[model samples]
Target: MDKIKIRGLEIWAKHGVFPEENVLGQKFVISADLYTNTRSAGKSDDLTQSIHYGEVCQFMKTFMEEHTYQLIETVAEKLAEELLLVFEHLQGIRLEIAKPWAPVGLPLDTVSVEISRFWHRAYLALGSNLGDKEAYLRQGIQGLQDRKDCRVTAVSSFLRTAPYGGVAQDDFLNACLELDTLLTPEELLDVMHEIEQEAGRERLIHWGPRTLDLDIIFYDDIVYDTPELHIPHIDMQNRDFVLNPLAELCPAYRHPLLKKTVEELKNALTEPEEAHAK
Candidate 1:
């Protein structure tokens, strides 16, 4: 990634804990590092291929002047989100907000807050076995798309498959969804839980019948294992239901730990074990 740096851009804004500070306002210094691939812009010398720092500065100044917040932390968080949303070409950003004038009587140089934010790609598997399974899956996808922090990039055709956990239940309609999201793995899980709950999902049995089921299959080629969640979904390689749909959308997406593409995994699952021994 190439960098376009904006350094020490000053602004007058009303952001402070004290009422008087808000009334009188103060000066803030903002610095940002915009990350993007500048290869096309560099070769073609096309302004359209690159983000204009001047426009960004004006946007920041107007945004600061228009909004009043008590804490710089809030300003940084909200502003970073706004910038990412507005600038489609930016891959990520490091933003800093500095307040030079302190209310404290004691001498101080400045206080500042800095944060880094970026979009992450993640894969999810959706399943439902209860009433109107297709409707539940569609609802789940819409719920994810509605979030400002999440973007649904692709969805595979739903598959009708029998239950895997030996539970005597109706066959499930399953599918895979790809997303570009700003939420961490845990945050994404929480969003999924909210969607499932909205569809009346219950947790009486492991792999039991449900109104909706959402699982995090992969997150940016990351191999993550935690107490609550597992990336590449534990045992997904052996599940034809998961691998088949995944292969449809991302046949070449490699599993970080297994180092095998989705197409390869799906083929391995269908191949006879005797062939593997030979």
Candidate 2:
């Protein structure tokens, strides 16, 4: 990653809890470190290959002046998201918003809010065994795509597979997708749950059946385990339904803990005595 630094860019904006402060704008100093791949720009000396700091500064100024928010936290968050969304070359950002004229009764040099935000790559497994299976899968994909913070980068062909867990349920439609998202793991889970609920999912049985099932299989090669969620989904390697679709989207994607590629995992799984697929 390369850096594009912009420091002490000053702007006048109305944002505060106090009425007087809102009426009379105050000076805000903003600084940002934009992350990206500048190799092309450096090699070709082409401005188009790099993020333009001048354009970014102008965008920040315009954005700050146009919006009115009570908290600098909100300003920083909104600004960071907008910059990432607007600038294709920018991969991440560390932004700081300093309020020189704080309304605090005590004398202080400045009050500021700083945050680092970046896009993350995540893989998900999608499954549906109930009514309108394919429709539910499409709805789940669309739900994720509809969010500004998430992008569906690739989708695998949906496959029909026999039910796991010996629940005697109908065959399931399963698939996988690659996601580029700004949401954290927990946040992404919440979104998945929301999408599942929208499709009328119920969790009465353990892997029994559902309208939609969205599982986070991987997040940026990081291993995460908690009571509520687990990355590199615990049992994905043994399930052909998951591995088959995943191999389609990312055959070389390695599991952090298992250290095996999707293709390898799929090939290694021992076929059940009863066929797992229709």
Candidate 3:
């Protein structure tokens, strides 16, 4: 990734815990390292192929002056999100906000808040066995797309498959999707659960039946597990319903743990069944 650095840009803004600081305002310094692909811009010598540092500086200056917050931490967080949203070419940002006029009695030079934020790739599996199965799955996808922090990049054709978990139930409509999001894994899970609730999902039966079931199959090739959620979703390699739809979107995507592509896993799971029928 290439970077466009802007350092020591100063601005006057009202942001502090003390009332006087808000009333009188103070000087603050801002710096940022914008991440993007500058290869095209460099090769063609075209500004349109890259993010404009001057435009970014102006946007940052105006944003800081327009908003009033009690802490520089809030300022940095909000500013980074806005920059990433407004600038289509920007992939990530490392931002620092320095407050030179600290009210502390000490002779410290300054106080600053620095942080890094970026977009993350996540894959999700969608399933529904109850009424209007396809509709429920579509609604779930729409729910994720509706969030500003999440974007649905690709989706697979929904397939009807027999229910798993050894619980006799109707066939389920299953599919997979690729997501580009700024939300953390936990935050994304919360959003999925909210969408499920909106679709009238219930936990009354374990895999017995559901209106909507959204599971996080992968997130940036990272392994994660918790009491409430699991990444790479438990036993996903064994479930064709998951692999089939996922392979449609990303056949070459490898499992972080198993170290096999989706196509490999799908074939490995089905080959034995085919052999038995021979």
Candidate 4:
């Protein structure tokens, strides 16, 4: 990724925790580093191929003036989101909001809050075994698409598979999806849980039957495990239900820790499973 930097743009606004500060107003300096690929603009010498810093400055000025928040953290956060949303070309951004001339009446000249925000790629495994299974899977994808921070890019055709974990249940409709989102992994998990609830899913038993089940199998090659969730999805490599549909959409996407392609992993499971049924 390349960079387009906007430095030390100042905004005088009514923003602070204290009543006196909000009423009196103060000066805040803001800076941003917009991340993107600028190859097209460089080669073509085209304005349309690049982000316009001048336009961004005007946007920041207008937005800051229009909204009054008591906290600089709030301003920085909302402003960062606004910039990312308005500029589709931006993949990541580092934002800093500085408060100068504080009423401390002593030493410090200014204080600032800095933070970075970026887009993330995630892969999801989908399954449904209760009610209209296909409908449940489709509804899950639709719900993801409806979210502001989440975008569904690709969806694999649903496949039929026997329930895993050796639990007795109806055949499951399984599939995979690719998404780009701005939400954190924890936040994304919350959304997935909400979708499961909406689909009338019940968690009475482990690997139990359900109206829907959605799992976060990958998040940009990240790997970690927590009591509530696991990345690279714990047993994803060993499960055909997960790898089959996943291979359809992203054959080349490899497990970061396992170093296996979706196709390779699927084949590894399929060959033995087929031989066993003989």
Question: Which candidate leads in TM-score?
Answer: 3
Which portions of model 4 miss their true places by more than 4 Å? 274-278
Evaluated at residue 106, the lDDT of candidate 4 is 83
Task: Residues 1-278, candidate 1: write the lDDT tens digits.
Answer: 79899999999999999998788899999999999989999999998899988999999999999999999999999999899889878889999999999687889999999999998999999999999999999999999999999999999999999999898999999999999998999999999999999999999999899999999999997888899999979989989899999999999999998999999999988788758778
Identify the runs in model 2 with alpha carbons over 4 angstroms from their true place: 270-278
Per-model TM-score, in order, reads 0.95, 0.94, 0.98, 0.95
Tens digits of lDDT, candidate 2, 168-190 = 89999999999999999999999
If both were scored by lDDT, which would come out higher, candidate 1 or candidate 4? 1
**Shift of residue 55 alpha carbon in model 2, Å:** 1.3
* Superposed Cα RMSD, model 4: 1.6
- Lowest summed lDDT over 10 consecutive residues: which window, candidate 2? 269-278
Q: Kindly indicate the candidate among 2 and 4 with the higher lDDT.
A: 2
Per-residue alpha-carbon lDDT of candidate 3 for residues 1-278, written as tens digits (9 for 90 to 100): 89999999999999999999888999999989999999999999999999999999999999988999998899999999999888989999999999998999999999999999999999999999999998999999999999988999999999989999999889999999999998999999999999999999999977789999999999998999899888888889989999999999999999999999999999999999999999
Candidate 4 achieves a global lDDT of 0.90
Better of 1 and 2 by TM-score: 1
Question: Candidate 1 deviates by what RMSD?
Answer: 1.9
Candidates by TM-score, descending order = 3, 4, 1, 2
